[model samples]
Target: MNLRQLIDASEGVVKADRVITGGTLVNVCTGEVYPADVAITGDRIAATGDVTAYIGEHTEIVDATGKHLVPGLIDGHLHLECSKLSPTMFADAVVRYGTTSVISGLDQILVVAGVDGVREALREAEQSPMKIFWGAPFKTPYTLPETTVGFNFGPAEHEETQDWADCYGVWETVAEFVLNRDPDVLRALELAHRNRLPVFGCAPMASSTTINALSAAGIRLDHESYTAEEALEKLRAGMYLLIRESSVAHFLNENVKTVTKFGAQSRRVGFCTDDMHVADILREGHLDKLVRMAIQAGVKPIEAIQMATVNCAEMYRIDHLVGSITPGRYADVLIIDSPESFQVERVFSRGVLAAENGRTVTAPAAPERSAALSPAFQVPELAASAIGIAAAGDSAEVLVVEMDRTVPFVRTRLDLTLPVKGGVVRADVAQDALYCTVSERYGKTGATATAMINGFGLRSGAIASSAAPDDNNIVCVGANREDMALAVNHLAAAGGGQIVVENGEIKEFLPLPVAGIVADIVPEEMAAAEDRLEAAARALGCELPSAFGYLIFLEITAIPDYAVTDLGVISYHTQSVVDTVLTSR
Candidate 1:
């Protein structure tokens, strides 16, 4: 079938604007290789065949010699926020890597999606060749208390505070104002559906009913399961599963039985990198590593590919445009020497050459410079007296942090009594681990309350990370209270970034101006910065996870034990929030 002749013969079947030839097609339909040509029209696959009879004078032709044509690789689940890049830059980078589509991770909710940010991202994504979809943010900085909580504050109270939105007003409004009054959840769902994008979210294990309700409301998938049992329940109840890299890795280390038990299910399952760090991506790989991990867990290679590609496209309703290289599917494909190895020979996106010999052909725009550092990270000037603790005796019993090895929820009241420094109960680091604090960076500046934590092998010094999306507050973790104070003071001096401080001196620092959390730098630069930071941590005698492991603790969604946000110390297991000032003492 020549390009013009194929178009003319199947006028109703296709309206191609361009044609591509000279590539082998990855027939995902049968998991085989074959030769074919493909034509595309206005972001959709028109027709595909030999296309020798369809050649036309006006049709733009791409000679994809020595390349493979298949459907664009689909990232089943990923958070653009993790890249810390804007939508355009993220799309540009991933497009060059042969990813034509991605399901935007739940980060939209935490950053700005509720304020029409999602629509804006979608609009910008359409300007590029790659496709973008988003999952709505469903978790709350506060819990859903009742169906009808009154917004009792009068106009006078509103005028008295600017901290309203960042701390409590916005959340209250979403509950009592937006979600409670307007049923805006349904409206948001409808808006996404109208725009033809996939909508998925976080559903905790305890909230099965809400999951059912979300499914009823048109949410098609979830990515927050901690166990195979939880995943199986959702699958049986009609929700597709997106196994995140962290969650899967955690569970596998705990016990691989569940995965070995249910690893082969063809439907209702897919892979997601979720919140992968740049260092991990560079050292490992993206979805390539995810697929490999699944296959190692006993999943079949073809089934893993289907989960990564076809199953994901089906959930997002883009299967017609991608997920296979059939007669009418786009020739976005990958050719490799071995399916199990995932070694790339050549790659195609929309039937056009994108990458060859394991390197990107396109250069995405450089990321924009970050905003100047904020003074909010500076520690308050205080005498040693300010770090005071009060208890009935020399030792005080407290709720020690008990983190679920897999899920984000932490168990509280695992009691530990430690030496009281100056009257303040403190972490017993020599026993193994201690606690840290992460003040929410989206609001007014405030110190996060300190709590007991374990797992990071820190003997001394402080480690700080931030989720300071818009606000400038720095989140800090330390075994030594004096080091915590000194690190914050130093950050005040150096601007914003991850810093490791020991005995009142800065050992290593990675300045991240983007949201006071991410760096403006690329993966390689960020990776180098992380290496330095890790060395600093090891110099202080800490080694278990990377120095960036504290980064995971700053995120409220994944950490289950007591966590410090701008709101104070919140017990995710108990749904109780205590004032930081009161809790630390």
Candidate 2:
């Protein structure tokens, strides 16, 4: 602050840069509302009171009469890459929804592209409207030896996170801990702590024993609670619950019962959209929609706003700089007509008008990003013979994954008999079984594995993607190997992307050439392609949740029950490669 200028403004000798007058300020810090005026000088708030005495000819004024002025909404946790839109496009989509800050999990791109990937993500963040922070990934076991991904962390990239990121804090999952636990995970946690970063835990469906172990290990919070029982357990274990309302994980309804269970201690709860797609965010909303859901579930509006703002900012350790409308902080304020209607008329960021009437006033200009940051794909070639299934007998018993249409994460393990011809086993679509294959993209290993899959509901046609979770590789499932090969090759030719093929022809496709994780396109373009893909998927009789995203996790090693990788099918209970032929091994 300029002492002379501050004194002059106090004495009505100089004018404040901007002012929002005649508003009921929702003071998140004090849980109070008062009719006041907010004065902004440059990027920081200069005063919060009746500042008419400091009005001058050059001062800009915003009329907030009868509006509730609250601090900018902060999204506690998210993966911006999940939107499949570049950082610039993602920011444009959410700023109008009132999210001024975001904490992004770096696992997706980090696993796909490594240190350069992390750097590119940070580079994109600098151009975004929201204040974006990183959550450094602890991929641990998958970062080495058997079934490793493309991304490898070195000393140089590790140094970059020191100043701007937090720990992902997960040791993969409870399954990995029980079977593949390592010392490096603990070392990573300690490093994060030494830097004063909070180690956020990933304890989905963990037993009470595991939760206690994690708490003792210095993990401070969890967003993996899927039920009220789970939520209460984590909260009682001194873990703050994120109450996720993601595109895939719908835990907010079940977790919100904790407000009744803990009453005032509900302050320990906040909201997050761990991974949401563009269409969902565009149609339903973002953190603002999550807050509205909380209120509908019986949480008071002020407390809900508190969870979205102050409590979350405190968790990020940036409360002094944001999370509330106070002096010496960025002027991020929302003008709301009412909490019941949840209508936002205006949004201000850094004392500048950002959004009004459901649109951004100043959308980020689309730029040709630097080549170093905008990565390209380089997956190797594979012949149609590469994705074949071999059998020794006329009929073979094979271990297949059973999927449930409603719950995307949970899968059932099953052993089934399949027909064999010419010492080869093929997908039996009549039995609702489709042949699935996963291949190593980065290594171009040409190593591929195929298995019979159920509950994915694909009767015909094939889908291929390079965004296979955990260790992003090429994964495709189809009634015929020929179509599967076509889908895979289509994605390869596009550099990196998702593809749909039917009856020897291409159906729908969406390219994601940057890091094999995100598409450098606007949300509308991406969402439109997704719409066509879903239509084609439905026409082919596939019944997965969202055709665009759910199938990509077919190989996610971090989740439970059963998953597949280019290496082989992995049983989460054992965390080891399961025998494809049930009787052989």
Candidate 3:
């Protein structure tokens, strides 16, 4: 921990505490690979490439004769709540895959628990080996008139983050607000610029004019570019691009082409798992999976590794503390089989062995549960009558939100006619259309809106979740009113979580007690619980790969086409509420 000792150790005047010998060093800083040795003193890398003079009898030697030493991967942008695991458990899951650090937005937690909740989650992350940095989420409710939230994050909250040590920058500056030059958003941007913090961007499918406005407003990085051309435009416009590969979204293959076709030197790009599931992390790996996918897409192995390491660190201006194996860094390194296979054999965090051979060796203790994070669902008791759609006549033509079978988040508005029984319209299962609802649960408003959706593929059952992104409101979809009421009430009674109900019985449930978004459990248990929920959905004739995963996107207003919120169905194209029922006859 002493600066003088580190300098002396680097100069060979003091013996290193640990020395890794006989390994090929993958220098990300210089993009070169060669045989070298790494010497570590305390939690800092003392020297690299032949530490013969620094090694002493007391030094612990690690054998890596055929392995390559590379910098531990860093995820530039992520939403930890999307994993459904607590911060400590999420770290435990990804650390084995060589992801030693991550930068996340507190938007999910901020909506439910406010600023205090954000601080509480950050404190919990400190106990883990994975270094977690946060960006101050300036937009909470996302948009007015479409959704509701517990807290409204603005310029005042941005100013408060200036004093928080781990606060990195403004998170996900929305493109629409910048293009419109919204006064509050501009004030927040000004505050971030005055503090010298980089503004993270979210401008998917943006036009040249919008990109220009965003750049002129000081937004520096973006992760929503879906195509190679989009990525090139953002890079040419002087914005750092984060190639993303999430559980539901797969944009890595298309975006990595920017590096493969246009060369890697001029483009500032990195990797991010914007919103990944724990099951995906356990089965396919984390950022390491992204690195491999990039290689498969024709990107050079070293360039792909650079995107996962130094590029992310430099984007956040944390290169001095991490992102490389050089001296003066945090000694976070990975021992991989080779660049082609990209197999991680060992992981070192802060000069200590944290994981080996796809397992954690030094799992940190779980942080104590915070009382403030306890779920506080305040919605009124619901009945089947409360969720039914009343019809003006025997039959009615309604506007339905159709989920794209391939991409669940991509929706389309469809007009269809349905029969009415007892003056109430019911879900037409034969047509593959089901009723969907979003209920406000933050105690501010007890509002709930119902709409019809297609492509869920459920023949008989209902699914609901309180972990819906952006607004964090309760979203449910079902074929019948009874099962829908059962699922919604079950989540309310259990504080908050996800549930699948069939025939008025709870088939499967996973409790997310932490602000109704994350569960305080280990990765294995969380994955198992999610697996059971998916299986339950399948048993009821649901068709999606992950029905619960698809259910959570119903309330997300950022996506295109249509989104169902507590207020009503929002038409993204029109930017206003649309009639769910088109005509009655």
Candidate 4:
């Protein structure tokens, strides 16, 4: 917007293009509510008050009587690719729920297509009604050489990305690097510090001392706190705490106690869904859902709104652009029924009416598929023998990665004996010990590693995913080798996707042909396909809450205990490869 026009509109010398009158404004900046009229000139909020003199012949007047005007909600941190939808589709899914802005590192796509892919995604984001701010991805593979990725983001990449117009901060500095003071990470952190950018952190279950170390490393924000104590420790260490509520991990209820019990201030706390499925976003609301849950958990209504809006913007250092219904800011406002219910009646993004009554007014056109985001699968054809674990004797004692049923992301190492037949270690279905494998798909090496995992509860089928976290390898788990091989091969043939196979037949498949991570479909179509995949998995005797959820995280090396990569089963605690079979006798 032109500075002179904005000034004239605010001074009433020129008429505002639009005016929202007769609403009780929820002032998130001051925690106060009062009657106000918002005047918009171009895409910025020109003024807020009576605004009687700003009315003219062409002025568009929006009557917000009996409504509460609020700043559009912002998600402090998230991975847009995890929604399994394109940027336009994801924006359509969340804009109706009052979320007008999101911050992401584009780390998933970066892993597959490198820096060029990130640039493609940013160009696509421009077509959406919602604002997308990017962070320079700090770590691409996210760990040691055990994890494979197409790109290795480091100081050079950071320097290039930090100069982008939309780049806000450095994204997700993992705890292992910060704690160990890795030289490459330190150099990246130094560049971020020199550029006056904040560094996002990933330190799950960190102690107070570790938190102190992280704070001293210039890390200013974290979203992995699963408990109220962890949240409070980050707060006391001068770090912003982003309470996460994702599809696989629900830590909001437990972490919100920092405010309800310990009386920690809400300014340093915000809301983020680190990763969410498209179906979940459709079923449950987006940031609007977080606001309601926080209010229901004994937080003040206004404070919950603050956490969803201003707190998040302040945490990312973008408060000057968004997070409040103040002058000199973008005119992104929400008309809600009331503060207690927080039901969004209408959404205005940059002074344009974007959505109303839980639906976007106009759906954004999907961007043309970019070549950079095309299918990334490069694995060789596989056979049942390729996925089998060979044994030298009749029986073998193996180290199994046990999935914790309560916490889907947490895995525990287990040692158990299993019978061998046909010189192959058979999965003991009765004990729920299933076979798991991670196959290299980047074509750097035709490698596949097999391991045993318990508590998946798959009785007679196999599930495979090419969207494995950190490294987008093809990870498969199954009751038998035949089904596992079928599932893996089917996924690669389809380019990239998640699939379930039963009795050597393909039961369900959800294609994610974009860099093996995102689907170029509408939100409704993506959600329905996910629902069908979940049902197919359930029909195959899978007992997890979300079968694909478990499939995607199988190769995530950042988590604790044990994880499967293309190299083998890795012990996160030891940072070394663990033998899948302990003894054969």
Best-fitting candidate, scored by TM-score? 4
Highest-lDDT candidate: 4
Task: Give each prediction's root-mean-square deviation over alpha carbons.
Answer: 7.2, 3.0, 1.7, 1.3
Give candidate 3 regions above 4 Å deviation.
2-14, 144-146, 262-267
- For model 2, where is the 10-residue window of minimal lDDT? 166-175
User: Candidate 3, 422: how far from true, in Å?
Assistant: 4.4
Question: Lowest summed lDDT over 10 consecutive residues: which window, candidate 4?
Answer: 143-152
TM for every model, in the order presented, reads 0.76, 0.92, 0.96, 0.98
Residue-level lDDT of model 2, residues 1-585, one tens digit each, is 566655555455667788999899888888887888998877667778778876778899889888889898888777777777777788878888898888775667777666566666667776666777666665432522247566654334434565553333332223244334555555556676777777676777878888778777777777788678877888888877788888877888788888855553666777888777788877888888988898888888888888888888776667877889987677899999877566677889877888898788875765565554345545556666666567787778888787766665766777777887766676788777778888777654657777678876778889888876667778888887788888887887776788889998998888887766677677778778778887888888887777656777778655667777887787766667877766521
Residue range with the least summed lDDT across 10 consecutive positions in model 3: 138-147
Per-residue lDDT tens digits for candidate 1, residues 1-585, read: 456644553453444556777766666567666677776554445666766445565667877676665556678767655554455555544554456677653232234222233344455566555666544433222232211011122223223321221211111112211223334444544555564545565554525665556566555676666667777666766767777664223443222223458553565566665555555565666666666666787776666667678778776666765787654555566655445655555566655556666555665444333222122333454232343334545676665555444343343435666777656776787764465654433333434455666655578888775433222245566678788777655555454567888887888877655434444455566667767887887777675555555444443422354554444456655545643323332
Q: Which ranking of candidates, highest TM-score first? A: 4, 3, 2, 1
Over 4 Å off, model 4: 2-5
Q: How many residue pairs clash (N, CA or C atoms closer than 3 angstroms) in each of the candidate models, in the order given?
A: 27, 0, 0, 0
lDDT of 1 at 86: 52
lDDT of 3: 0.85
Q: How accurate is candidate 2 locally (lDDT)?
A: 0.74
Q: Mind giving the per-residue lDDT tens digits that candidate 4 earns over 1-585?
A: 677877787787888899999999999999999999999988888889788888888999999999999999999888888788778889998999999999999898898888898898888887777888899877678865447777788888887888888889999998888777788789889999999999999998898888999999989999999689989999999999999999989999999999999999998899999888889988988999999999999999999999999999999999998999998889999999999988998999988999999999996787777778895578888888877577889999988899988976888888889988888888999888888999888888878889998977889989999888888889999998899998888888888888989998988888888888778788889999999999998987887889888778878767787888888888888877877888999
